[model samples]
Target: MALTNSKPKIAIVYASATGHTERLTEMIVDASVSQGLQPEIFPVKEFDLKELLRYDIVVVGTYTWMNGEIPRQLHSLFEAIEQQSGDLVTGVFGTGDRCFATYCGAVDLFRDMLHAKTQLAATLKVEQMPSAEDRLRCDAFMNSVWRKYSQHVENLVAAKP
Candidate 1:
């Protein structure tokens, strides 16, 4: 859809317990800035679910815990997202120890749900904290999301009466 005159609002909503997800969020935010786009990052508890309507792009980050279960704190957001119409563009990413069978399984869970509920763009999985090498992957993820969003906006504009 054609965005308003104002720049698209992007949100990086995440839940990080041991700070790995938070660190990844920082990397995403930095990549966004480098692309000349400003994005706001919010902890899952702090983000008002209703505010989701205001964003054109939504990025979710989390850490996979025991048995690949979605963390308790993020469950609400997960449900809220699933209830949303499939219009918003979305990306999912997370951190998990590679030793686990379900490494970054939380990201997979979110990916499935978001694909059903929104326009899923990219999904990323990083083992533990992101290292310097992961920056390229992060950039590619952001770029893919932005490219899809831009295409959507262009399609909307072209369809104008």
Candidate 2:
């Protein structure tokens, strides 16, 4: 959906296996609100697939499953978003254990697909949990989302006759 000069609608949706992804979601939410953009939050189970197009930007959070895999809970959501995808600005974040051969593999997976299917803005991956240092990355992630949204609005304006 193309956003007008009004604040662009954004949704932060996630599937947290053991709460790590949820914590990261909270961080992103806090930072976004602090920056004056109120994003709606949805646990993957609670989010309605039909409502995907209501927002101009969609942020996804996930926890990597064993040996580099997208958690089963997120597979449908992934496909649903992809099926309806376009230039919907997207941001992906994930959490995982360092011992895994592919740490944050789900984030990488979503990142790759979103880069192709949507207007991928930024991506972030955290170890099991976030630290104070990770807050900087979270802030940067939000900045990237906003920056991309701004660019999209500019393009829309430029395309006008």
Highest TM-score among the candidates is held by which one?
2
Q: What lDDT is obtained when candidate 2 is compared to the true structure? A: 0.89
Candidates in order have lDDT scores of 0.87, 0.89
- The residue-by-residue lDDT of candidate 2 on 40-117, one tens digit each, is 999999999889888898999999998889999889889987876576889999899889899999999999999989
Per-residue alpha-carbon lDDT of candidate 1 for residues 26-126, written as tens digits (9 for 90 to 100): 99888888777799889989999999888888899999989988888999889888888776889998999989888888999999999888889999998
lDDT of 2 at 64: 93
Stretches of candidate 2 off by over 4 Å are none
The TM-score values for the models, in the order shown, are 0.93, 0.95
Candidate with maximal lDDT: 2
lDDT of 2 at 74: 88
Report the number of backbone clashes for model 2.
0
Could you tell me the lDDT of residue 114 within candidate 1?
Answer: 92
lDDT of 1 at 112: 92
